[model samples]
Target: MTKWSYDTNGTPGLDSVHAHALVCVTFSVYILAQVLRRQVRVTGLVVTKFFMIHVMNLAMLKLEAGVWGLVFMTCTLLYFYETLPVRYLPVQEKVVLITGCDRGIGHNLAKQLDQLGFYVYAGCLQKGSEGEQELVRNCSSRLTTLQLDVCQLEQVENAVNKVTNELGNKELWGIVNNAGICFVGNVETMTTADIQKLITVNYLGPVNICKAFFPLLRKGKGRLVNISSNAGLAPVPEMGVYCASKAALATMTEVWRYELQKWGIKVATIIPSGYKTGILAYDKQATAERWWRSASDAVKEDYGKECFYAKPKTEALLSPDLSPILDALVDALLSKSPKAYYYRGIFSRALPFLYLHLPTTLGDLVMKVIGDWFISKPLALQKSSKKF
Candidate 1:
């Protein structure tokens, strides 16, 4: 915007003649020095400087133009900050169907996306569930709630059909496979039904949704977002079944990433940490409650109530708030070149990268320290042999 002598566009050209661009370029001169001062790695310095330089150039243009320059810059930054699965598969005024929107992270995402102006197709287990209805009501013009149980193909198809009718063969944005469940227990005591339930709802559910929606997504060149967890990376103590399901999902995302990349469709696995939502609210206290009741039930045996409920391992839970995690997932869904994996959570950044980089034993040791610190005090799990 150098008040450039471009003479043609009436705007400072982004070239050798522009002093503003030069000023913007000059900002990067000391960026490396600033990074070395902070002892940050040159790699990080490179990324930070790149973004900063873009911002500076953008700000200069904003001053040169009307407010649109700033708005465009903000939007551009956000666009690059995330990757989505719809480059080759493009959709206009497209629809996105999300599962498990009745509660928890799913509900949060449904609400956020609808507000962002996408035609949000929400699939929930039950119609008029209080939370689901609230979101539908709030989402208003952009939202549509369909009753869907992912385990049932017919229900899924019905929702798809409904969307098709509304869309009339229009391209679809695929599905955000977000619904999932959790449980806590040693694998020895874990029931087959429980394991199957986790697999059904968490693993098979996404596959089912993907299979049914691929035609639509193929048309739209859409993306599929698999909401996974860090437990998928480092297994959790009591949530053996939960961990298995997410780990299965992580592998599935990788496979889908390779398989679907050619179709102009992208599959992104958002492996985030556990967050507080309806499910966490249910699981956090209910886990302890179940332990309490089960302890009462088992008290008559040798290992009494104290061993189960009062043990230190069950005391503290690692659940963080859901807002940030949900925001990240929504962000990934909107990205134009979504990645194979995105981690979202405070601890998520370090933990999963560590899982990929650290030596197995060292990673386990770090995880073990986490296990020892985050759980209820006087962890009874310490007496056990199984690590996960």
Candidate 2:
């Protein structure tokens, strides 16, 4: 064999330069195409084009970093590709239980899985609610609807018993912990009761459901799919309680993943970005009014009546498509090897990456700027003369 000599010169070889250039150009093109396709309005298009130019400029800056940069880039691409294989297991023999099937992602996922031939047990909070009724109307014989309140331990046990009785010799393959609630308010404005409610529904609900169903999952060598939020990964101002609750659930899921691996029970946490679901459609104004009315005179004076009542201007930040989340959930459930963490929706992956990589000060500053731009004072507030 011929001996090889390593390059000792500081200057990059021609091959290295060409490789770096190719990577920069290819990535810039892909990003530009994504921006153009997703952004539809004239203003959005102009803004996106400007953003893409900035990204291209950053990409060009990597060209001067030489061989090491190119090598690192190549390795990253290879690792990403290797990790994202699409291997799925047959679900016809599997039995799945999904909570909060009365509406939103849970409703859609239950339907999709039912259609895919999984014996789906949908957990609805209300048996005869409009959403449950719709699910009943649309579903096939493979789908079964059960009344489930994840927050109540007795109800969770009853659901477990019902599913156990129904499953007979078949094992319970998966449990989708999709039941949750969202509460938006400043920490000062949010009452003890409000915080408790948020914690009960968003965090403890999953805990109760998972604990009851984990044994069955172990028996089946199945998976647990928890529907978390992007807020769990990166906390947002004014929605502190909601973020905290989701964060708790995420941490719990991670711990369970470590604990359950011995039994071949996979755990997946799905962190979705904003979607136009029932949670987002909540009447913020009415909630604000209720908080204002309950506030003590001393508490009211410090924050101001206007501040307490202010409704942040709401807009859909990401695509309303529930398909991505549903697909991710299915992959977590049925894939022979599922990802431990699935970040779904636009900006879901990017935002978390930035938050984890950026300096603490820089990340805080970025968040502050975003909060200032998006959060605004309420358009209307009832005048109050009361002072502590």
Candidate 3:
């Protein structure tokens, strides 16, 4: 290290360095603030103010304008970036409906929405289920839980009737299509019934809810947040059915944006990678019980289980936190305009990014390798254990 010379006055060497670092940090934060100008003007201005003093002092420094200018310009351009805003719209107390409010991401979302001061209207297949009842009891004062299986037209209609009657045809600020089901099995082994049930629960269920609630949303001039998946954007091996439904849902969300924009319905799809939610646990338990059964021992030995069979232990996966997503959903519901998609968590984003943008061959190679990695490890471990 170079020996530090004393300051002209009494300031220490470390203090000078700290001052310089503060200037650099201030400049950095100023640039970041410029990015938020379009989304939230006041917030961006606050960031600009944070860096002003440092930037003014540093203006006399012998730094190259090219470097700082480039940083500033890059941040300016980020305002126009295509991704969803980190902070969307302000939270407001407006009527909201969310399907699949019993458990998983939906349960978390409902709670968070309620906390955020929205008039939450949660829908479930059955109201009296232990988990469902518990959620209903603890929600905010404005919450209304109703038995409405999106798959059942009568139930959906009944729920709508209740909302219209109770709220007196008040507009709905948010609608979350969170209802989903997974049927895990090999494509070769999956029966028609398995695929059908998954499709009904994942795709048609959302569609039915949308159809029923579109009028209320239009009246409220709110947003639609669909809980799609990274699988919807990029396929998952051994999860063809789940992927298909989500893919369809993603497609439908896009179309809805196009269709409903004139009606003041902002649409957003939350596409996350596989989450370590109740869904994954349920699938893992079900897969363990039946995937290897009724199958030839030769098939199990030669082909082994799929990579997704080991997905439950995926550390990168985030458990559903109703806060961030619920915040996003509420924001989307209130935004005058919204992005097509919002992504969160770790692999939830990176995996889909690679799959969608990579060249077909390269993408296939990566996916195949991931597939083999997840599929092979457990089988290898099992075999080694057996030998011992």
What is the per-residue lDDT of model 2 for residues 147-236, given as tens digits with 9 covering 90 to 100? 898877888899899988989878899999998887667777767788898999899998898888888889999988998888888867
Residue 182 in model 3: lDDT? 69
What would the per-residue lDDT of candidate 3 be over residues 1-388, giving only the tens digit for each residue?
Answer: 2234455796535333434455466655654664556544345645455455355435524353433443553454344333334445666558888898788777777787777777888887788977588776787668888898888999988988898888764567878898888655556455456678889989999888888888888888888889988878777766778889999999999999899989977889987654555665565656544655645666567546552254533545555454556555655676656667777666668888898799999999988776553344445456788997
State the number of backbone clashes in model 2.
0
In model 3, pairs of residues that clash are: 273-348, 307-375
What's the residue-level lDDT of 247 in candidate 1?
88
lDDT of all the models against the reference?
0.68, 0.77, 0.70
User: How close to the true structure is residue 292 of candidate 1, measured as C-alpha lDDT?
Assistant: 51
Best by lDDT: 2
lDDT of 2 at 90: 76
lDDT string, candidate 1, 1-388, tens digits: 4442454668644433254445444544554554556433345545764776476666656567433444454454455333312322223466888899998778888887777777888888899899778986788687888888999999988877887788865568767898887655444343456568778999999988888888889888777888888878866565667778888988998898899889988788887764565544344454545555544333325333333332324224546467767655665566555567777666566776787899999988876775554334333444453466
Query: Which has the higher lDDT value, candidate number 2 or candidate number 3?
Result: 2
Better TM-score candidate (1, 3): 3
Candidate 2 stretches greater than 4 Å from native: 1-73, 310-314, 373-388
